[model samples]
Target: ITAKGKPQISTMRVIYQPQQGVTIVQWQFEQSIGWLPWEKLGSIMNDKILGPMMEKNLDQLRRLIEAETSSL
Candidate 1:
């Protein structure tokens, strides 16, 4: 899913996920999303500097996870 872009930089990735037979989600959680280092979803969700944002983020993630696991 990664690719090269400029002479020295890489092209950003734009991820997509399908739901109900349609594309319903798109996100890029990489630290490359900002000025920080590269980080995927899991580590970012548990990061301390972003602890405040995590409360809300994790809650949403929990809801999504529950919806996936329990159809709730």
Candidate 2:
């Protein structure tokens, strides 16, 4: 998806599976280091921002799912 006249792309795959009556989500993000031979920026982004952001988003997803499940 492109937004604001800017070009961007992500290499991520999300898989959903049910285990023991619960939903399990497996997510993988493929790293990209374009035009730069070094990976320092990618490493820092993953460690400092992307990692925590993903965790927080997953937590929010879980809570929303559980809330709706309980109401069902």
Candidate 3:
């Protein structure tokens, strides 16, 4: 999914492991920086920039899921 005014692609996947009785959710965001040298260099900091945001989002998702499931 593309966020408003954001030039990036986001993907989410849910995988269930019946044997392990667990589910795994994965999220990824990808942004393309042009082949310019500066852009290529900036790409190296992508994780440092986006990692905390991703973790926060995932934590919120987990809390929401747990709340809903607990109600059921």
lDDT for every model? 0.46, 0.61, 0.82
Better of 1 and 3 by lDDT: 3
Ranking according to TM-score, highest score first = 3, 2, 1
How good is model 1 by TM-score? 0.29
Measure candidate 1: CA RMSD: 10.8
lDDT of 1 by residue, 1-72 (tens): 334231222233334455543332332233333344543453466455555664576569657866897964
Q: How would you encode candidate 3's per-residue C-alpha lDDT over 1-72 as one tens digit per residue?
A: 223353777789999999998889999978777778976676668877888899999999999999999999
Candidate 3 Cα lDDT to native: 0.82
How far is 33's C-alpha from truth in model 2 (Å)? Answer: 3.4
The clash count of every prediction, one per candidate, is: 0, 0, 0
Write one digit per residue (lDDT tens) for candidate 2, span 1-72: 223343334444555555645456655454544555445575566668777787788789889989998999
Off by over 4 Å in 2: 1-19, 34-37
Candidate 3 residue pairs in backbone clash: none
Give me the candidate number with maximum lDDT.
Answer: 3
* TM-score per candidate: 0.29, 0.59, 0.71
Point out the worst 10-residue segment of candidate 2 by lDDT: 1-10
Cα RMSDs, all models: 10.8, 4.5, 3.9
